[model samples]
Target: MSVKPQSASAPFAGPFALGTLAAADGPAFPALVDSEEQVLDLRTALDDPALTMRDLLERWPAVLPRLRALVADPGAVRRPLADFRVLAPVEPRQVFQSGANYRQHVIDLHVAHRAPDDERPEEERRAEAAEIMDRRAAEDLPYVFIGLPSAITGPYDDVTLPAWAKKPDWELELAVVIGRPAYQVSAEEALEYVAGYTIANDLTDRATVFRRDMPQIGTDWLRSKNAPGFTPLGPWIVPTESVTDTGDLRLTLKLNGEVMQDESTKDMIFDVARMVSYASQSTQLLPGDLVLTGSPAGNGMHWGRLLRDGDVMDASITGLGAQRTRCLAEES
Candidate 1:
């Protein structure tokens, strides 16, 4: 599950920094952007023990220049990549999750739970969804739910399956890392608040999504999604400048090396800018807030599969590095 270090002879040009892993004493340091390297022995790039990636985001304008300079300098400290353990890029203060934003994913769910109707054809139902999707895009409102930061875990950490969860599933999403304050901003100006992007697997407990006892309350995402290790995030963050297009990146998840979810951000009913702008209406997105762009189709439920103990999920977004998560069952 490891890769070779970047060749010393040919190093890529500067302007990117987002990898972080635990050091011998404490807080993870930024990994080098020097070519395609997996060696962590490069030494601590940022020596601030009290600082986390959240701090970096707050001071992005300053840290970014330091990152670029570090990458270009040849004699910077480095250690063996295998020595350090990976950590989530940032421990965000607030997390906003967009729901029902993927067109095809919603259609798939509708088809699965469709009622028996003699008059209307299946095609008619799909057409209706498409129309609704168009209206949603046109409308300024976007649906978002609040999530606890405690649910966050390292990109490669194992997800602990609670005993209460009957059917656990994976929802791989593109997570937008907020770098600046945003309040009631327009969609046209939302991207300016982003620091970078990372991969997120929003694990949900399907069976517990709704409380049958209180059907009137609707979906319960907290129980269904905020388990100890529900949100697996980041090998590192890819700076916004490095990402040329957020609307067209491909997101894919492989379970045990078998591709399950494969779709592009192009299918999103509300793109990243819209989601951020929508969230900022009521919430003041601070320096390390996160907006999880809803996941696309091909979830395990749609594929007649659900996660179990010993299962592995390898998720990746174009440009952003990959994440590996192993699913484990909880014991009494």
Candidate 2:
């Protein structure tokens, strides 16, 4: 006996999804989707004239049931994805990025900055870093930073390396999109506030990360990480209901055709719920707010190969579609 091949329309391809998409000549619009190959045009499905990702998220409680029904109905206005362009799923009102969240990434950073004359065995150095990370996770709060909305660009857009930037780097992260208001939420209840997840390339200017002018003030993230087009975000938003495990996802990034970062979210020092709950303690996270879970190891600083003009980066997380960005030197 022979088995039959599965078709694109089959249920085995995984559950359906929703995304923000547009035609080649139009502005972004909300969508109900099946896969990259099949998109069900949703502008008419939604009666609102100004529908957007933020709009969907704000009305998530009411829209979710309709979305599920649309997922089952196969006769909606359909179009091949090749005819449409994907956009950043949401225009966030606030962006919060978790810093130093991966255990192995932290260890690599510590080992990279050893003193020239410091002579410690590799095993000893590794052990020390691990111990510090363990203590930090147990006792310390997650380090969260604000990101400007102006820094966000479409997933396939060109990223210009500012003329003043010398050591630009790539940090691909898994970012959670908030669907409901969250203030003073407990860690155990935090996941309920999430709308979905998407991919973000949190581009950084490594050389300017620290503030030499005011050592006391320490890091200057705005100058280093929020330059125009620094955050290349989204090909699609994978709804929270579709994702069963936030702690286990394979994330990978490539420069041109060569792989640079390949790691799992299980390596995170602080998991997604902890980061969201910790962030909400101080800030009111509204619908469309973005909580960026930090990147894994294999950044430019760790690899000794920083980003430059003419390089292309392809970053992806499981289920959340991939993003491709081309780098260019800023024009004078």
Candidate 3:
């Protein structure tokens, strides 16, 4: 299955991006993908068969120059990208997910999801939500949560909607990949630790988001968002230098050919640097760790539409490439 090449307005800023790919006869290996959708086998180009994406990221400062040289004059024979199966670009040791970080998204949820007894005017509810969001952005830190790395799946893989997940939904987001150790970093210096950017669809089981049995404890992120294949990540990692503005990229997610979520990174209450800096305050973020900025407005819940079997999600972020994931019902 050959993959399609990026159009004239390619999302990647650099001539090439790093990815993980596997041929039918071989194990997964690090690769370099060009705009034409041709892949250079990095394992062979670097002459280190054991090298992984994590290894490159850990030594990014050193590896970057070498990668650039290879792209300039790739003497090695390149293969069609479709010849190999694309996998998640990196295997993160830790995943930090920001929640309610997008301004309009929060407002949309606030207006759409109301108490059954409440009968406020639509405009009134919207105005009140907007005011609350403004205050939260000014006074509160980003709301972040931990996600299991085990939930990650390939960009084009099939996601099994668990039988118990009655209200499955899609949340396409911009993911920040860490290049260096970051602890107690300030927002001003946070971008220096970034390795690159990727796309992640943080699928959720809305029905299980809130723990009814224990309202005091609140959200059950593990059960609601960490199911296997819940996080469909990456066709490749676009270097941070490739992105001109981390705070101004477009994020769009389409379900079964219908546009559902369409918004820009500018709508985010907490930008990439702020989100990473906030996460670093408590945890020592290592190389390859992923910090997912919150998804923008237009989730399934907002449209009163939920995921069903055989639904396909095409999610993309500006210049970071796209992911195509198919939804399947868990077998009985």
Best by lDDT: 3
By lDDT, highest first, what's the ranking? 3, 2, 1
> Model 3 over residues 201-279: C-alpha lDDT tens digits?
9999999999989989999999999999999999889888888899799998888889998898989998899999999
Q: Kindly indicate the candidate among 2 and 3 with the higher TM-score.
A: 3
lDDT of 1 by residue, 248-297 (tens): 98888999889999999999989899899999999799987899999999
- In order of appearance, the predictions have TM-scores of 0.90, 0.93, 0.94
**Stretches of model 1 off by over 4 angstroms after superposition:** 1-15, 24-27, 30-33, 38-49
Cα displacement (angstroms), candidate 3, residue 330, comes to 0.8
Q: Model 2 clash pairs?
A: none
Alpha-carbon runs more than 4 Å astray in model 2:
1-14, 115-117
What value of lDDT does candidate 3 attain over all alpha carbons? Answer: 0.89
| Top candidate (TM-score) | 3
lDDT of candidate model 2 versus the reference? 0.84
- Model 1 collision count: 11
